[model samples]
Target: MALSARELWRILEPVHGMIYFVPEAQERFAALGLDRMAGYFASRAAALGPVSGEVVVATFYNFNPVIVHAAVPAAWSVTTPAALVEARYEAVGAALRRGLGELADDVSELAGLVRGAAERACEVPQGRPLFAAHAALAWPEDPLLVLWHGQTLLREFRGDGHVAALLLEGLSGIEALVVHAASGEVSAEALRRSRGWSEAEWADAVEGLRSRGVLDAEGGLSEAGLAVRARVEGLTDSAAEVAYAGLGEGERERFVELARPLSRAVVASGMLPFAKR
Candidate 1:
C-alpha cells in the first residue's frame, strides 16, 4: 500500500507533540524562567539564519499573530542565541532521558526503531526552511535524542508547508481554524478564545468561509470545504515528500512500522491528547 498522508501524520505528530508534554521538558523550561515558550522555540528554530519576527509571523500563519509577537520579546531580550540553542538541546536531552527511563524495558528496542525513522527521514531533502535549519544543527551524541530532533525537523517542515498551502488556498489564520473546527478537529469557540481572536473577528472569518463554500450555515464543512482541505493536505504531503525521497514503498512501510510502537508509547505516556472521534 502507498504511504498516505494520514499515515505519515500518525507517524510524525506524536514525536512532535511529545516534547511539550514531557515533564522533564516542562521542568527545564521552568528552570530557565521562561513563560509561554512554545512560540519562542518555534521562532528561534525557524530563524534558519537570523530572521525577524515579522517574517516568522508571516510564515507561521495558523497561530494567533499575538502569540508570535509575544515570543519576539523573549527571543530578543531574555536569551542569547547560544543560550537558547543550548537550552533547546539540553531540554530535549533531558526529556528523552526521562522518557527513556520511564520506558526502560523497551529502551534498546525503541532506540533502534526511532533511530531508523530518523535515518530514513534524513534521506529526504529539508524542503521547509525551519526544518532545514534544525536539520543543519549537530546531531546529539545519544541516538534517541538524535531521533527526537529528526522527528522535530520533519514536523516543522510539514508545518511550514501546511501554512504555505493554506495561504495558497486563500484561508486566513482565523479561517483556517474555522475550517478545522468545521471538520471537528476542535470547537470553534475554543479555538477562537485560545487564538485570542475577538468574537467579531471569528464570526467574520466564519462568514468568509461560508461565502467561499468551505463552510455551511451551521459552521460545518460543506463538500466543497472538504475538497479544499483535501487539497491542502495533498499539497502538504507533496511538499513533505522531499524528506522521504530515498525511502521506497517498502522502506516507507518499514519506517512507519518501526515508528508505530514508539508513537503508541508516546501516547500511552500521556504526552499527547488523543481525541476520540
Candidate 2:
C-alpha cells in the first residue's frame, strides 16, 4: 500500500525535530545569549528575517503571544537573524552527526528524495509564510543538513495548512491545544506549560470548547470534537500531499524505507527528548 502523507510525516519528523531537543543546539543558542525559549523562537523564526513577535504569533499559531514577544525582537538584539540561521544549521548538523554516526555517511539518497518534495512545496508558497521563508534560504551543502532542511520545510508547509484547518473550525490557538489535549494524546498540563498559556487562559478556552459542544463535562473530546479534529488533520494531510506530487508511489515508498531507520536511529540516540513526551 502507498504511504499517506501523515504516515510520511510520522517517519520523517524525528530527523528534523531532533534539533529542538538536542543539547548541541541549545549550547549553540546559549553561546549567542539566547535562552531555551528565546533560542527556539528566534532560531525557528530566523528564516523570516528578524520578523516581529506578532509575525511569529501568526505564523507559529500555537504559542502564547506573550512568550513570543519576550523572545523575538529582543532576541534579534542579541543575535542577528542570519547568525541564528547559521547557528541552527551548525547545531543541527552537529546533532545529526552525533546521533546518526555511520548513518550520516549514507544520507545523500534520502536527502535527495526529501529535497525533491521540499522543493515541490516551495513552488506553491502562497499562504505558507514559514515554509516560504525557509525555502528562500540557500540549500545546505551537506546531505544530512539537506535532509534536515527538507523536513523542516515540509513540516512548516503542513503546519501552515493546519492553522488554516483550525481556523476553519473556528478554533483559536489555545483552543486548538485544548482540543488536542482532550484527545488524550498529550496531557493538558504539558500543552499549557509548553505554550506558556496561563491556567485562566486555558480554562477560558476549555469553557469555550465546552460551550461549543466540542468538549464534554469532563474536558474530554465529545463526538463533535473528534469529528472536528479528524477534519482538521485530514485537511492538513490533504494539503501536505501536494509536496509529494513529484514523487511516484515507488519513489515515495523508497524514501520512507530509507528514512525510517535513520529517523529511528535519531530517536534511539535519545537526541529527541519530546519523543518521550
Candidate 3:
C-alpha cells in the first residue's frame, strides 16, 4: 500500500542515535552516482504503504531485526522525530520550487543545484537527489534522517554479548543442539563452514540462536529476531547521513568525489574479504 501523507512522514524523521551504523551503503550510493539509485529509493518509499505503528516498527526491523528487538519498545517513539525531518525538507523544497519558477532558462544549473542540495540534504550523495526532494515534498523532515538511521542499525548487525550473540559471533565450536538446527543454507552454513568448524560445531551455533529466541527450531529468523534483522536491512540511506555528517564542510565535496569512484570499486573488487579469512 502507498503511504498516506501522514504515514510517509512517520517513516521519515530526524534521529540522534544512528550514525556509524552501516557505512558501506552511503559509499556505494555515492560511487554509483545519483541517477542509478534514486528510482529505487523512491520505489521503496512508495512500497512502504501507510506508515502505521506497525509499518514504522517494520522499518526499523528491516534494518536488522536483532537491533530492533534489543532496543525494543524504546525505538517506537515515531511522532517527534518524524516531524522534524519532514519540516526541514518542506521549507527547502518550497524555496527550490520558487527559484525554478523564475529560472526557466537556467534549468540545467538549477537542476544541478537542486540535485547537489538534495544529495547533501539526504546525505546520500548523487544517485537520486530528487528522491530527497520528493521525500521532503512527500513527507517533510521525516525523509532525511529516520530511514537513514534505522537502516544503518540493521546492516551494522550487532549481537548482544549474551548467549546467542556470543555463540553466533564465533559459530565454530559447541556440542549440544536441537535436531532442527541445521538449516542455515549456504550463507548460514558458510558462516559455520568458513569458520572451519565441524558439524557438531555448527549445531551448537544453531542452538545458541534458538536458546536465545533469535532463531526458531529450524534456524530461520524468529519474530523477535526478525525485528532486529529488519532494523538493519534498509541500511544504505541511513548511513549516508552519517557519512555526510562526518564530512564537514571542508571535506564534503571530496567525500562526494570519492564516493562516486569507491562505490564502483566495491563491485569491481568482487565480494568483500571475510574478516576471518
Instruction: Please tell me which predicted candidate would have the highest lDDT against the true structure.
Output: 2
Residue range 42-102, candidate 3, lDDT tens digits: 2233223323333323332212233223332232232223332333333333322332233
Q: Runs in model 2 with CA error above 4 Å?
A: none
Model 1, span 228-270: residue lDDT tens: 9999889988876665665568766766776666666666666
Candidate with maximal TM-score: 2
Question: Candidate 2 at 113: error in angstroms?
Answer: 0.6
Ranking by TM-score: 2, 1, 3
Question: What value of lDDT does candidate 3 attain over all alpha carbons?
Answer: 0.32
Candidate 1 displacement at residue 210 in angstroms: 1.3
The alpha-carbon RMSD values of the candidates against the true structure, listed in the order shown, are 3.2, 1.2, 17.8
> In model 3, what lDDT does residue 182 have?
36
Pairs of residues clashing in candidate 2: none
Task: Give me the displacement of residue 201 in model 3, in angstroms.
Answer: 1.0
Per-residue accuracy of model 2 over 1-277 as CA lDDT, tens digit each: 7788888877999998888889998999999999999999999999999889999999999999999999988998889999999999999989889988999999899899999999999989999899899999999898889999999999999999999999999999999999999998988998999999999999999999999999999999999999999999999999999998888889989988999889889988998766762
In model 2, what is the error at residue 20, expressed in angstroms? Answer: 1.0
Q: How well does each candidate superpose onto the true structure, as a TM-score? A: 0.83, 0.97, 0.27
